[model samples]
Target: MDSRNLIRHKTQVVCIGAGPAGLTASYKLCQNQIPVVILETNPIYVGGISRTVNYKGYLFDIGGHRFFSKSQAVEDFWTEILGDEMLTRPRKSRIFYKNKFFDYPLKAMQALLNLGILESILCVASYIESKLFPPKEIRSFEDWVCKNFGKRLYSIFFKTYTEKVWGMSCDEISADWASQRIKGLSLSKAIINSLISPNANQDRAKVTKSLINSFRYPRKGPGQMWEVTAERIKEMGGKLFMGTHVC
Candidate 1:
């Protein structure tokens, strides 16, 4: 290709990624009559962590994407993309401990049934002890979790999973990572939330993404939403350059 023919075109907004963040921004820009260009490092696909992968006509989520957010506009934007193709799904997950299964989001009654009276009593005592005397120096993930949920619960629920994911002892991992990734709810908050009905505020701003029970998902896969979003952007006079890798 001649350098002269490869003259760079000008754009008002240059989106560096074609993932959810970049694509969403571009869609809004195009909606408001602004010109934009998208640059994605991946040769194909769009949703980023929320993207779905296809194998021989079978689609699978690369990372589970529960399209839940505190922002009504964000939720609306997702609905605008998929419309009826979106499905609101109830969450169902479980915790495995000592050959026992406990429902997640933890119904207190279920936990009591699963953990038994003696174990439950010990867990409560541990929680009270942690509350009364938090570890003096809170540095590691273990320290943080034990201080909040208690040593017993941490050992059963957190320690194993944390080690498995990071392949490091909890004492080695920093507490800051917990603050950044696991915000909104704590062990105390989870217990309280389970005991009561959702607050009647009805404000989307108050909703926490992590604790929400229901979320929207594309009927086919998350990739379908992005595919349609890209098409709409093109129809609105936005340029989509596929198979183009940029640093």
Candidate 2:
């Protein structure tokens, strides 16, 4: 073997995939004076699936992935890197159901009122029925959500979009995803929590308080942050090979 190849590498770390997770890891590692190399398979984009794609001056994403971490370290790191370019914007999420739109994270009363009396009555009936005749074991996503929130709500809000995203029937999908994603959330629990503690979702004085109002987004797009970081890495005598595919 060549002497250069035989020599030990001095770099402290090597990270695969230049996506947000990998990039953040590399950034933190380098901050501690450790040499790091980030290997990305895709040459054109450094931000991976979360990266923005520019087409004729219009920006689009593979999917709508918003940055909203409850971690202070994550928030601080993003703010530091992006600086003022990160704008705090309000979240505007909604669910399309039966040719009508409903608030997401479902404010119970509002959702019920919006769903109207007949559907709402059916929803409550289903909930009581499921509770009385609970499945011996929740085996699938549909079964899990239906058992917790009832069939009417699940059919209107979850079934279609989830099927579209996963390309699988809710019955075919495992219940683990539902359990993890909506952990500690139920229609009764939501109503009770909202009534008892109106500010439960507020950004309170406590470090563990939930954030409800706003989120940070890059001025142009998320890709801008990675591009800037790549430039900084190069300025610090690091190598960055854009448009070069690595197997």
Candidate 3:
């Protein structure tokens, strides 16, 4: 292990983001004896959009991001990196509908009951109308959603928030988003399932269960995890370049 030979044979791996993906890659590479250089634009932080920020001594995230992967390898990797800092948290989500807060993955009976007789009747009517005269091509997201779940349900559950997120009207957006986001979901099925078997293996129900439940969070937030990983990488003869941007 001569110094000259070490300098000559040094392996270099440059990772750009220093986010979860980049940090994980760097960690694995270092584990295999490969030298890594992480370049990040933000000088004060390494985590990307998933980064956590402290405001008035309170840690706040860019959004509600949780670490929950279906892959065991990913889970194991995080557990190894985070150790006891990883905490399992119960999920709490709600939907604001007609100035009322309702549990997300909307309880069908409760939702309909809350909508009242007139609105519920309109929802039923819209569903019946769509069923009788189904759209010819299902061109837009609005059309697809209305056809499947009806106008009232779509307006209540999908319209405003979706518009806010995508910055587009339901008609302007592609059906692909709706199809992928709410695949195999329908108001008729939801109501019937609620009445008959609420716990049936419906695709939407499964997706909802997978989403709103429990998730892992680092003790100080996601930034702490990346900071520790970065430290480990540096300790393993890696170089981290902060405030470096690459176009």
Candidate 4:
């Protein structure tokens, strides 16, 4: 690449990518009256994984992007960005395995019944064994999950889905990833919650992200969020360079 052909800009801060986090950073910098420049490789889209694809007047998201958060600040930020345009929708997730539908967050009675009496007994024994004698080293996602939910339950509920989504075996993935995603969730807690408050409020701060029963989303798709945020950033004097790559 020729030096003269390169585009140059002066800014106190430079943000790479126009995803949710990057755009949020730029928006905040602009709010504080700081000079910031954002560089996004994709010229046509801004939300990265959250981007909405338009095909012949139809809109679709790359993946399901739910707007549920336990943090008040996160909720406030989304409301600030797209007020009145967000829709509250019930969360319905289920796993199809062995020709049976299993609820996510695992309803104890339901899951046990679905797995059958013999399998359920084995699962309970496995869970008790894990509680009694856990693996000394917690290194990978497999270790973390097995320790928390037992090998039988982990294999049934988590292993295949996690590998399919992330394209990695449980042993290959770091424990940190599991810790972050499955934090504050345990088999015991889930069972107790299922029995007591089966339909807990999704907005409650105590509700974990994975267990939320409802969430908010933009009318057009999640991309609308970044698009609006980008406009707001520009309105506040922040610069955005699309179709640009940082070398």
lDDT tens digits, residues 195-234, model 1? 5644421222145444566778899888888889988999
What TM-score, to 2 decimals, does candidate 2 have? 0.75
Model 3, which residues run further than 4 Å from truth? 1-11, 124-152, 162-186, 198-211
Q: Write the per-residue lDDT of candidate 4 for residues 118-219, one digit (tens) a residue.
A: 999999899989999999999999999999989999998899999987778999999998988877677876666667786542323255667677789999
lDDT of 3 by residue, 1-247 (tens): 9975586468678899888789889989888788788899888777787788889999887656678775789889889888999999987767887788766556667777888999888888988888888888888899888888777778887788778756789899888777866665556777887788866524454465333467899989888788888888889888888899978
Judge candidate 1 at residue 8 and give its lDDT.
23
On lDDT, who's better, 1 or 3?
3
Of the candidates numbered 1 and 4, which has the greater TM-score value?
A: 4
Name the best candidate (by TM-score). Answer: 4
Q: Rank the candidates by TM-score, best first.
A: 4, 2, 3, 1
* lDDT values for all models: 0.75, 0.73, 0.78, 0.85
Model 1 residue-pair collision total: 0
- Off-target runs (Cα >4 Å) in candidate 1 are 1-11, 135-144, 159-209
User: How close is every model to the real structure, measured as TM-score?
Assistant: 0.73, 0.75, 0.74, 0.86
Task: Show the lowest summed lDDT stretch of 10 residues, model 4.
Answer: 2-11
Stretches off by above 4 angstroms in model 4 are 1-11, 192-206
What candidate 2 gets wrong by more than 4 Å, as runs, is 1-11, 130-144, 163-184, 192-211, 237-247
